[model samples]
Target: MTSFIRVVKNLLPVILLVVVASSAQGADALPSWSEGKTKQSIVAFVERVTAEGSADFVPVPERIAVFDNDGTLWAEQPMYFQLLFALDRVKVLAPQHPEWTSKEPFASLLKGDLKGALAGGEPAIMQIVMTTHSGMTTAEFDQIVRDWIATAKHPKTGQLYTKMIYQPMLELLAYLRANGFKTFIASGGGVDFMRVFSEEIYGIPPEQVIGSSGKTNFEVRGGTPLLMRLAEINFIDDKAGKPVAIHQHIGRRPIAAFGNSDGDLQMLQWTCSPPGPRFCLFVRHTDADREWAYDRASSIGRLDKGLDEALNMNWTVVDMKTDWTKVFAFEQ
Candidate 1:
């Protein structure tokens, strides 16, 4: 039986080797993304950047990656979180401002006519935000946001708004960070609003988030210096403003960028236009059953011009219907 024991011992090493190789292969494969050209391209690009001894291997500091919020990182379907906040603000302030009972947008909002409420366009939206978000200290505003997020439930899904974040995108963020990449969120949403839960939700800190911001004044309040928010618009971080915000906030051009819709087109163009190793990805919402299916026609997060440019620029387009196995964390 000595020969039998020797044979078993000899096979053990081979078995161990096979198991290790299989695990390594699995690690390289992102099963979360479906088997297709898009998935293949994403993996290839990541491998090129991450592979040691490769010419395209970017160092940590230079490996800055910027992602657009809203439809890219999370689900911005039915309506945006900021719009919901505006609606809630309208509700709260309705009792105080009885004139809103006869106002166009406010009356529509009170009557639950979303379409009518938004008919007044950007001007109306800004009015809602200014009225609700202004006249408070930054700290008070932050606290108000915190309180709202803690109790706010999505109007249609009935789920906590934070829980609606895409699971695959969350995984992607972790994967990028694990590969020594620093990710930042450059969104059109209010900076304070995003800073409220970005760290807890996406592992992105407040400093890493750049968004539309209001003017603030430095003042000594009671015992310490405080930055009081003024009732004036400072920067609107959208469209062309995206690249400027990136440059001002990050002080460096990003090597990688991810976004959805035309608002982020400029940011992606800025990243990929440079003569160097760069990667840009556009998250396409094509899943109807899971979360949402929108592209050309949607009022919010419309992916028209950006979609055309993505094809022309050879950017990786993540097809939500095929690429992702799951959408939101709450889905599973």
Candidate 2:
């Protein structure tokens, strides 16, 4: 019995070392994030805010984190996903709108010339939006968006649009929520449009999303009441408008903000301006091999002004190529 006990005790350290190593590996909350200052800053911020009895410890209810949808949570290269949806919608309805056969922008769209269609700028884009999005009940519009997103493929990558969401951001969202932070999306895309996929893809509920919107009216049709969409601008949730929408919808200032474009500058400034602990991060697209590489010169999802402000404000900027081990979840 004495000899057997001596042999068992001799192997104990090896067993303990394996268990300790496994526990340490399990402690990493953001596995998709590569080892760098960007990831370190993110983890440190969360730790400081959540540590009990610490000076920077924030209460659960006050741990609000707002994230922008396009270019932040998902890939917005080539063009915004919402714009793609709108274009596809136009094509689907083109057979009915025969007048579009000779129209300027619509004619270009029908010919699959996305560049020519958008050449007219905001006026041309708004025309497509109004034609496709308006004149339907809210429920009908919801169904249309749901159906389109389920099957639509990104033109370049050939992946479903939802599949292009950043894996690192997905880990970040789940990590924040696990730590009692309430996550909300403040996007420039249409509000009703985002609500369709926000819950399914990001685990954010419909009410937690705020975005650009058009006017709607409550009406009863054949004893059934529904909200009818209108063809007029209601609110634009980009640039300075982001902060205003945050104030109106959230009713409290966010403690952290994440985004990727000049449009998100005001939102990040609002989040980090107050005299308190806050976090602001912008995702920089720098991977040409795996994803896109564009910033200052790009028309869509421009990051010029936001990049300058992020540097001046000392906010963390995540380089997609370096800060993340993998860009898409499927890569894992």
Best by TM-score: 2
Highest-scoring model, lDDT:
2
Over 4 Å off in model 2, which ranges? 1-26
Q: Positional deviation of 109 in candidate 1, in angstroms?
A: 2.7
Tell me the tens digit of each residue's lDDT in model 1 across 19-116: 99898768844556677897777667777888889988887788889999999887787878987897898898789889888987788889999888
Inter-residue clash pairs, candidate 1: none
Q: Which parts of model 1 are misplaced by more than 4 Å? A: 1-25, 102-104, 221-224
Cα lDDT, all candidates: 0.87, 0.92
Per-residue alpha-carbon lDDT of model 2 for 228-300, expressed as tens digits?
Answer: 9998889999999999999999998999999999999999999998767899999999999889998888888
TM-score, predicted candidate 1 vs. hidden true structure? 0.89
Clash-forming residue pairs, model 2: none
